[model samples]
Target chain A: MSQTVKKTFRCHPEPDECKGCGRCVSACPKKLLKLGSALNIMGVPYAEYSGEGCVGCGACFYTCPEPGAITIYEITPEA
Target chain B: MAEVVKFGRPKGFFETFERRPGSIKKNMSYCPGCGHGVLHKLIAEAMADFGIQDKTTFISPVGCSVFAYYYFDCFGLQVPHGRSAAAATGLTRANPDSIVIGYQGDGDLAAIGFNAFMQAANRGENYCVFFVNNAIYGMTGGQMAPTSLLGQKTATSPYGRNALTEGYPLKISEMVSQLESPVYVERVALTTPANIMKARKAVRKAIQINMEKKGFAFVEVLSGCPVNLKMKPADMDKFIDENMTKYFPLGVYKDVTAEREPVVRPVPTFEKADVEKALYRELPGGDQEHESCDSEIFNRELRIKIGGFGGQGVLSLGLIMAAMGKYRNLNVSWLPSYGPEMRGGTANCAVIVNKGPIGSPIVDSNCDLLVVLNRPSLDKYLPELGENGVLMYDSSTIKEVPAVKPGQKAIALNTGDIAEEFGNLKCANAVMLGAIGAMLTKHYLTPADAAKFQETAEAAIAECFAGKDKIVKMNIEACKLGFDKMQAAL
Candidate 1:
């Protein structure tokens, strides 16, 4: 419904620690993250996300549960 | 877009998970990101939200559920493995106004306690059953459970379970739904945030229904066991999402509260008179019969010694004395001593009855009365009898009458022959008790004490052989024989 809205934020996921649990994939309100084929250093799958439609509301990060799995960061526009 | 991160742990949990040196209390026994931790938070939050903490009586069964008592800041009853629902059933019935929560794990509920859970649900018992079905046994090493997947490999099922031999996983929520009693039934998972929210609703609803006095409400939680699943914490959640969900679809299976009415069980009575009616049938009062003149002769505590061969009703005689004292509202105690060999060894018991509270129950040396049915008992306890103490023996078993001390009273009767006339040798012990009862009357005691024990002796004999009318009649007749024989000697 808000396709015309400008992009708001970015996501910071610790790739090495991600166990590819895909909790954010199910918890993401904007449907930006997915459990992709990319494997981390531990040989476990990991979730991938894009900044195009990312609102960075932190639902994905909040529901991740596993510590150090992912982090949410704001993408501020230039002043 | 300046995103602000605002999130914190649930309020019911402790501030920090760190354990300092020599910390006495541990927060919880849950693994990181485990479904049990989330479920515990959800349940505690729901309990707090409903304002039922004061009324909650949590029943935590074996397995990991046993650790729930450490988390909930409320009254809890830790039950044996597979008996959570049964204990909850009793608690809810006894205190209909209280909220009872039965918390169980898969091995506890679905497997070992399947019958108990099924009975509680089928009866539509008023309680909330929160069954956590985490595929495999978590507390013990990974083992095949009632809800284990067909191809799941566990410690017990080293090779993956085969449908041909191991059978399919039990669908408990679905099975419970078929019953018409439960007002609510639902199966929810803890795989994702959305599912967890749904699970929260189900858990809250079940407790809410229980608070409303509704019938049984069950919530089956499809949890994850990452340790046994051979996966990381998050991956286990994904396993539940990908595999467990397909086997156990999440949804509400029943909601019949609209058509159903609340059940109200009658509260029980607490009056002492009611207790009397239930137990002894009548409050004990001084009987008019057997009134004696010298009931006040003896004013001190009555310490009695009754001894005989084993299996000769020595314990029964002492028990009758204690029961009579107890029934008459007197403090009483019966301490028995018997040799190792049950049938042939000497057996004896001491009976102490006081009008007031008793201090020490032992009468090691000084005894007010002694009744010995055999020579060995007489030889063992004769010299121990205090001055003025009465000694009654069955002469049929003793060949000679021993010399009695000057102040003490001694009476011997053919008790075995009297019992033989009554058609049973077992009545011989009853005869000795009768003589002791007769001596306690005006013959040897203060008039008040004699009167206090008068009507009680026959009544005690009657109550001792209760429901065995024939034996009671014979024992009473044998007792009267011993009484008349001892009375003539005096």
Candidate 2:
């Protein structure tokens, strides 16, 4: 059987659209996400991906109902 | 004993009294008579009393108590309203040594947080939940909450809540106590001195149990909201005595201490090999097969809608149908529309079964099959069905409705009457499920697959009627009757 490679992904939050609702924080299966002080172009507090021991369950990506607020993609070996 | 010689005061002598070394010390912004303040104080006092202040972690909700981190002298996380239980579950599961407290209000606990609360309780996570029942939405300015008593007026209920119109208040404490996983479940009040004493004892016992690393523990506190109720301090006691106590009586609903000795969870060791072995043991092949199958099915989609009254088992029926589709190796998804409108109003659920990966679970406009339980549900969703879709309804209640557009197939079944003839009113949902099963099984499942569906339905029936086999028999008959009716109609 081939081993399934485990990968890590970082979710970037658009501060302009974030209401600091903490929906992503609650939906994260790994609990590695937190609200950061850094403001985005819209001056709102965006979600900071801690990426500390993330399981990559994509629970946050699936449960987040906000459109264009949460952008998630894989962090390749080069990056 | 000899007198101890003291040098200059120790460097950390005042540190003990200053504040919890790791906890929060900020003053909270909760209003007076708001249960959140009292609950915060009780939780903080519990942590201090147990000497776990530094190790305690508090999970805050979104309502008036959203600023729970302000008062607690410990690590705190301000989470979304109604999701504190879920967050605390995650935190406690990851760091089992830390004392996790989930603090939530009536609106957050009973309204939008129902699924999270139920799933957590069902899992029996090692966390203490302090449910503060204020009956009205305080943060949102007196909106009707799930715990709002019948005939009670709120911002949304200008006229008193009518049972026939608005439905009854949800008894969450009693509901949670019914689950088998909870180690302790109790309801206490802070209205009077006697009640407050009981509440303190309950809170203390809950904290002590947490310190012992026990399983799930819950305490529902019947609290007051003077600002929301618009009641004077002097009238608060009378209001609670006359109004609140009638709906939320305080008592211990479940305590399993006498039944068995406490089971201690093994301290987790940090070993990559152990983690890998345990992960593989728990999830052997992973869920890749299930995911890939669902993706394949989603790649050819079909949308189906099922509607009925609140207690007619519409949601479960829809789930069973979706589960059957999954068992037959089809892609399936189910979503239930529930809330206040479900009590006296029509209830419905949407299921999307496909051959490939599906796009959305929510049914917005187009649907293939519309199963209506009542006239109102039919009237509400009839137009949303596509021109080629089939519409089915319970004929017992619905007599007349607006004309259906051409190209849509409409069929009515006397489901309630059929269930009554079978001597059970609850089996109408089973009948509808059987009907839907007969129609969809040919393409997605087999006769054996339908039997598997019936086996599950029967097991659920038997469990629901543990001591009453007659009821189970009647429900089975009802299922058969509905299946035969659909066969004849088709």
Candidate no. 1 TM-score: 0.67
Q: Give candidate 1 regions above 4 Å deviation.
A: A1-22, A33-79, B1-29, B54-98, B110-126, B161-185, B192-198, B232-319, B332-352, B357-393, B398-412, B422-426, B442-444, B451-454, B464-474
TM-scores of all predicted structures: 0.67, 0.46
- The DockQ for candidate 1, computed on C-alphas, is 0.18
Please tell me how candidate 2 rates in CAPRI terms: incorrect
For candidate 2, write residues B1-490 as lDDT tens digits.
1222121111211223233243322223444344554455456556765778778888888887776565555788988868888898878777888888888888888888889998998888888889988788888899888888887889999897778877889898899999988889999876654566577789888877777767788999887777788874336546776788788787999988556355455667569989855633332222334433322223556788988778887887787667645554556688999768646656789999876556789985778788888877887898889877777778788887546778877766778887787677788887876676555454344455445656655655555456988876876677778878876776
lDDT per residue, candidate 1, B1-490, as tens digits? 4554333234433343343233423335554445676677677767777878888988878986575766676678999889988898888888889999888888999888999999989988899988888889988978899889888899988888888888999999999999999999999887777787788889889998999988999999988777777886567877887888799888988889777789777766668888645643334654423223334432457888889999888988898888777656555778998989879789999988775556677766778888888999999999879898878888899878867899988877777887787688988887776777676663666656655554666788778888998887777787777777666765
Best by DockQ: 1
RMSD of every candidate to native, in Å, equals 7.2, 20.8
Candidate 1: give its CA RMSD in angstroms.
Answer: 7.2
Per-residue C-alpha lDDT of model 2 across residues A1-79, encoded as one tens digit per residue: 2345455555665555454545457556567778788775545566777756655454443323232345565544432
